[model samples]
Target: MTPTATGIAPTTNSTPTTHAGPAIEITGRLGERYDEILTPDAVAFLTELHHRFSGRRHDRLADRMRRRFEIGNGRDPRFRDDTAAVRANPDWKVAGAGPGLEDRRVEITGPTDPKMTINALNSGARVWLADQEDATSPTWKNVVEGQLSLFDAIRGQLSFTSPEGKEYRVTAERTPTIVMRPRGWHLVEKHIRFIDRTGRGMAASGSLVDFGLYFFHNAQQLIANGSGPYFYIAKLESSEEAKLWDDIFTFSEEYLGIAHGTIRATVLIETLPAAFEMEEILYELRDHCAGLNAGRWDYIFSIIKNYRGRGARFVLPDRSDVTMTVPFMRAYTELLVKTCHKRGAFAIGGMSAFIPNRRDPEVTQRAFEKVAADKKREAGDGFDGTWVAHPDLIPVAQAEFDAVLGENPNQVSRQRDDVEVTPAQLLDVHIGLPITAAGVHGNVSVAIRYIEAWLRGLGAVALDNLMEDAATAEISRSQVWQWIHQDRETEDGTPITVAYIEELIAQVLGEVDRRDGDRFDDAAEVFREVALREEFPTFLTIVAYSRFLVDTE
Candidate 1:
């Protein structure tokens, strides 16, 4: 077992049978029924949760590179005056709605592959985010076939066929409520390796190997099918990465005896420093918190990688002109529905990645009237649920969260309390409107059509009708590397250069044909080496997964 330029090594008397120690080995290639999901108790519960929280996720990723070198030497991220007594405690609330997540209006995400996990658990959409991060392309055979298609979709033993023989399954009597998401805490799982407490050997936490192998094989079969072990948390920034996911969900509910608020989680206020620590990250996961989402293109690629070169008042515009009804994405979704209904939780909303082109009935009626005026403005701004990457726009975002939650399964009691926002209006990014040339050739044709479908293993594509992923190729190559280092210009003025994005990536890789012209000319030289490089990598799938997707020897 050798393979290394990223992973694969295990079998020298395999291991990881934890009481929180040794047995951290399983390196990679375990295909064709990956030992029913790399078991040995899911590699000893992801090597005892990466040897207990990989040192608080490497000291919160070295306090996120010392707060991105103090927001690149000017420091602006506000709201955390040392968490202000956990956001002034305002009668704490979080852990309440659990069991199949008490109706999540209309979720529906993608990529767990077995035909988008049996068409997102038969897509009626009451929640089915099931992605293994940015609609997956993790490629250790799509992360061990997305944990064997969510372990045959929580025991319904998933189905699929399609090499034009069309099959697919999950004829829902009850589905959707799956949640999952994993991979972000800056991804790793390089085929898995462990030895941490200083013996060194690393690469593991793709958020604790996708939440410790899906909470060690579906936490008691998704808590005896009433659905527990849910989660979505990705790219967190602070509330100390939500208290390192509330101490890895209280050490995975006391190492799977399961029951301490039976693992909930939602967060993903998508980093502009997690939208001013949304009430101290919902009071540090108020006991496995389940709320807060609006992750619009990774919150505009975390506000162009935390305000790159902080000038032109944090310039941003044209990643399809930033609209979640603008004012800095409506002050980060009205302060995430007033910090998740003032802590009772459940906010959600953001993602109508729109993909309906069944022979274009006027491009699916102008994308269903722009996803019905964006889910009737997130159900008239209180949200309780919203996301639809396509299941025919899930009854148009569940008929606008069922006309503002009718038989009321949620709205978490709509306490937006005339929301107040601020942190200079979530860094207002000088009220948007600028960059164009059709948004710089729609960010060089959606970053060379999503890095040539994420180096061919594919990570959710759909293209022009929308549904692109990997957070839309990381907000289209971080807005073409912050519009070629802010020489931005466009809208007929010109500037955005690097030789006009390498002459529009050689006229869009010479109109792609010869079997995808050398993977769109290696995805336009990995999108001009991470968009005309000057060092703003942050994450373009961590250097395109160690240079054009790993798997060496």
Candidate 2:
């Protein structure tokens, strides 16, 4: 029998409290306690709590996380925003997705390391993503320290004290935009303050949100600073979840002198349910949603978590020898882009893996070719970008994205505008524009993006989304790379060419136009769905699928 805290009865069972006590440990599902912080019942109860806990309990604990760690207890009576134009930016709502939504870019993610991020940046895709939550050490201390280092790197730190001095590529920083994946709740406030100070509060121009409430508090803090901050919200499962955030934003700005629409937001589409309600969520939050970014790993984990009752049917069996390109991974990427573009926000793709694959030089060349082909496919579908892990593979990553952007189109490149866009103006695009029928992938941007990815090799790495690879994978992918010249035919037999790529996109767009009308109908929406169809890579997916999207059967 176990020892009793009160010495009452060895056999007497004690109920667990929301807040752990010495008598009742706070353990995770495995029943292993950290300093006797948990018990079996505690673990079981916590797991159930994630799905069924009442609002009263949620409010109490969430408030604790905020008050104790400065994570965010909900309303910030002082927070205010002046930049409402970001909400009404015309660029946020691109009419006629062309194919899928991520039609213009791909992501090449690396670890949180500076070297890894720079490498991926050299590749060519539009965004450089960094992470601190899943791929990096999850402890509070390491995460806070690691994220601060990235912030320093981004601000172009100067060492007036030390002659040794350190500097990054170009005068300031390369790549059009920067994205970071900071630690979630556990170290949220610490991480935000670090980035803010490191960047000299330049984070004022940046948007920072973590994976959960932990992530939101940082953004709240930033907004509370008499400024505006943007965010990419992750792990969300429903439109109701979207509404909570909307309400959170609403209340956060109430009383504060800030503009209601200043806080731009994008959703990290990770879970299956989120993936399923993609379009509806997009439509519902069309006023607030910035865009949808793909989340492959978490998406897979979600299917396993939520669909295990279906047995083998839930996830695919592990297949060796070939890359794990599951139908669902591909499907998820496609749907993400479509959802984002349909509503006018950028449809961004996610990272492939944490480790760089392709150890043999020949294998590397072949893999690059395959990845390039896939990028073209995604561009044709409509994804604006995708993610990469290794800097060496940046070129490979960008080569794939080049096809979708097409000569820059001379459009405004900033994330926000100065004046408000009326709902009527937005509705005109939503209801009046014919659904785009363009689909194809090929161009200088594609090759340039790849070149940039390799150059970054992690040195010019991203700060958002914990997509493994980064340092370790770079060497492996490089070891296997053959460095063949561009425009070579791939192992998949797809010839690389801008003209041919454009034709491909045109075909896909034509099909999309046929499915989408001036007005939306449920069945038409289903047909336009990028996920429901498997064999055919929808317009957006063809561009976003990298080697690491993960195969879901």
Candidate 3:
């Protein structure tokens, strides 16, 4: 069969080789074992599997492994029903620039603090990550299910008005743009059947791989019924995992008579392993992806528990401070923007747990201030948007997002015709450059990237251009990126350049001079002023050098 124009090759054998069209095919020796790709043992195992099980049966095993172990391939239940409807809705127009679907509206699941989603919508929030995952409490989780049933029951007469003396009621359809949070890695089955769609059976139970397969099967079941998400897929670790789901989606779409590319998917970069594979996973599922969100809490835990060696401890923290300040995390978020933007995807940041006006009024205010600061900071850092749980905080959150939404980054990607250099990439690789006395001349690379993000409105920021943004309150990100960049390599192994780099620093710092003039003074800063002055700068220096000679090369 002729596959899609890009040659839809199934990453797993369970996927149909006979696609809508054949774009890619593997013609090598057929193997049923993982080791076959390299060692003789692998090959021998595949040989045994080939003889032991039918081709279709063996493909199922590989398919399952790819889903569970791979991390980011799991699906979120909230989106299960609306992808196609939104796509088919007469109002569902495609976005001109963002990745996946263009109508980047927020989905206000009945339980997702409706006030928050509504306000964010008013304030230009792109999409809300409403869920069972990180945002909602357990009580809300149970209530959300009931809400779903209410909305689903009156599918037709959805609008109702509660009169002052009387009351208003109508069909309670879920909000269109909110992304649902799954129960977690442990409860994907429950999420898939009832939460994702209406079902009450063990048919939905399975492991990570099995859940992914169910997504395909379920999507196929609902495609004609006008149900099922395109999804905010989660818990994945490898590009192979992404490819596997892509295969399943492809196979299922064909069976269900849905157009192959209509099903959109997003990955939750919730852990360190998932973080590293961000680019690759996006690349692999470029056709089917909606976008990627940085899962802050999970990612923080993952960094500590799983990716401790990868410059994590410093950016995150040992204490409850849990700041996403590590050079690597900063780079990760910036790259989240860069990777998604490069491919025209939406770069969404993780959630802010700063629920406001709590029992601790002071804590709530600080939390509010922190959220407001974070919004502007992350926006400047390259993100298109971010998330929050409380309605009061949404206004500040929306304000921050809006500040930089259309602000073209004065990023230093410009080059002469036939030019092949970029500031960020240059700073990532080419570390042999001579050093200045402040430190190795090579250390300047760090300052360069940090300055770039700042100059480009991504670094050193404040709200209303005041002490509002965290970047301005701390160190500039482009500086860290520049240092990391010059020390790092381009994806193609080409060395990055330093010319645009220094310009980035000078230009951004120049902006700092123009707006706040380094009066980035803060009695109550995101990080304590004393700590920022004493340890952060020096720590950044060490991180910069680590990039210069680290095994990243």
* Candidate maximizing TM-score: 2
Assess candidate 1 and give its TM-score to the true structure.
0.33
Question: TM-scores of all models?
Answer: 0.33, 0.47, 0.46
Clash-forming residue pairs, model 1: 16-23, 436-439
Against the reference, the lDDT scores of all candidates come to 0.79, 0.38, 0.40
Better of 2 and 3 by lDDT: 3
Better of 2 and 3 by TM-score: 2
lDDT of 1 at 415: 87
Candidate 2 structure quality by residue, lDDT tens digits, 1-553: 2211211112212333322222222111211112122223322322222222223334533643343233122221111133233323434442222111223355544455444445444555455455553444332233333444344434444112223564434232444244455432212221111111111211100112232222222334444433234445655655555655565545444524456665555678865556656655555455555577776555554443333223222222211111224444655565555445445667666654433344456655655665666556655556666665555566776665554465652111322222222222211211111111110121111222222232223222221221232221221111111111123233345543434433543443444333322221322222223212222221221222221121222
Off by over 4 Å in 1: 1-75, 80-83, 87-110, 115-129, 136-152, 162-221, 225-229, 233-263, 275-279, 290-300, 305-309, 312-446, 451-458, 461-468, 488-499, 514-553
In model 2, the number of clashes is: 117
lDDT of 3 by residue, 405-510 (tens): 5444222122112322232331131223322222212223233433323223231211221121221212333232333433533334433344433443344345
Comparing 1 and 2 by lDDT, which wins?
1
Residue 40, candidate 2: alpha-carbon lDDT: 39
Could you tell me the lDDT of residue 487 within candidate 2?
30
lDDT of 1 by residue, 370-395 (tens): 98898899888988888888888888
